[model samples]
Target chain A: MHVGIVTQTYQAKIYVTLRPSVLDPAGTAVQTGFKQLGYDNVGPIRIGKYIELTVSADDEDAASQQVDRMCDQLLANPVIENYRFDLQLAPTAGAAK
Target chain B: MHVGIVTQTYQAKIYVTLRPSVLDPAGTAVQTGFKQLGYDNVGPIRIGKYIELTVSADDEDAASQQVDRMCDQLLANPVIENYRFDLQLAPTAGAAK
Candidate 1:
């Protein structure tokens, strides 16, 4: 009899942001809009991308490594952006099915 | 003698995500792209907005309130998106000057 390997589903929250040295035109534009809306005190706003995804892996370590590889390979533009992620065990794996 | 109130600067990290009932076309497109890149194990991807901004306020409570108002008014679309934020005291207030 062969036993099936159980895989756990993990939820990852990834944040991709422009490097400080890189210019953020979109952020500047939004700040200007805020000022025009009478939020004169708001300034230096920066915008970034937030992604949530589910991955199935054998363990937490495997899940984290997978997320890291995904970010480095396709989620972030290395030259001008910085990426970080947090991984946690999903409350339930049923949704991932 | 008149004393000046020293306002502390707080940094807010805001996340805006689509509601569960809403469809995420961009996320689906990205998931397809990931599969094309050979990340077959990744699925159910959702994309959203992340924002960082500094607000000067008398205290943490005031800063939190300000961030909440900003999210409700400008950072997120209530019709389909939900917003949450984390506020912390900035390491230095000089940047906001």
Candidate 2:
């Protein structure tokens, strides 16, 4: 039985931000709401969606190609939102690492 | 100059939920906070981290395997947090699909 794992990793340092000159009404609303709730330390809260996936495959290569295609096609909006992804493969049986 | 796009796709349905029997103080607090903010429709807001990545790979296979290893090794917490990832590959040169 072959197993494969798909994982997406985002450190706290990663942030989703709007273009400098662009206006962000949603972000502004969240910021105001946070202040009203007594969260003084909350700075400009730039919110972005984070998504990770796990997939099983016969060959890791084929699986990877399919995944990349999904992104450019429908997942991330290249015009307003930019995203990055990482893939993790299960170890082979006979190979000793 | 081959480009491999690492993409993580998540639908709104994906949620991070605590075990039914387990105690979740964080969830409780958030729920209370939402109610106070006039979001009466907000149910239990389960918060989880979403991460996506983009890497340039020489070959799709090698890239896929390497990414899988990173996930089980570090990214997703197998114990409490579970994650799923989707990969999308860029089109190959001189190959019409």
The TM-scores of chain A alone, one per candidate, are 0.91, 0.57
lDDT of 1 by residue, B19-81 (tens): 999999999988998899888778689999999998888788988987888788888999999
Task: Say which docking band candidate 1 falls in.
Answer: medium
For model 1, the stretches where C-alpha displacement exceeds 4 angstroms are A93-97, B94-96
True contacts kept of each: 0.76, 0.05
Write the residue-wise lDDT of candidate 2 on A12-86 in tens digits.
111233444556676567557645754343234344544333333434565465445444454446677655555
Off by over 4 Å in 2: A1-22, A58-61, A90-97, B1-97
Error of 1 at B26 (Å): 0.7
Candidate that scores best on DockQ: 1
The whole-model C-alpha lDDT of candidate 1 against the native structure comes to 0.87
Candidate 2 lDDT over B7-95, as tens digits, reads 32211111222334555566566557545754343233333444333333445565465445434444445667655555455333222
Q: Report the lDDT of model 1 for residue A88.
A: 87
* Number of clashing residue pairs, candidate 2: 27
True contacts kept of 2: 0.05
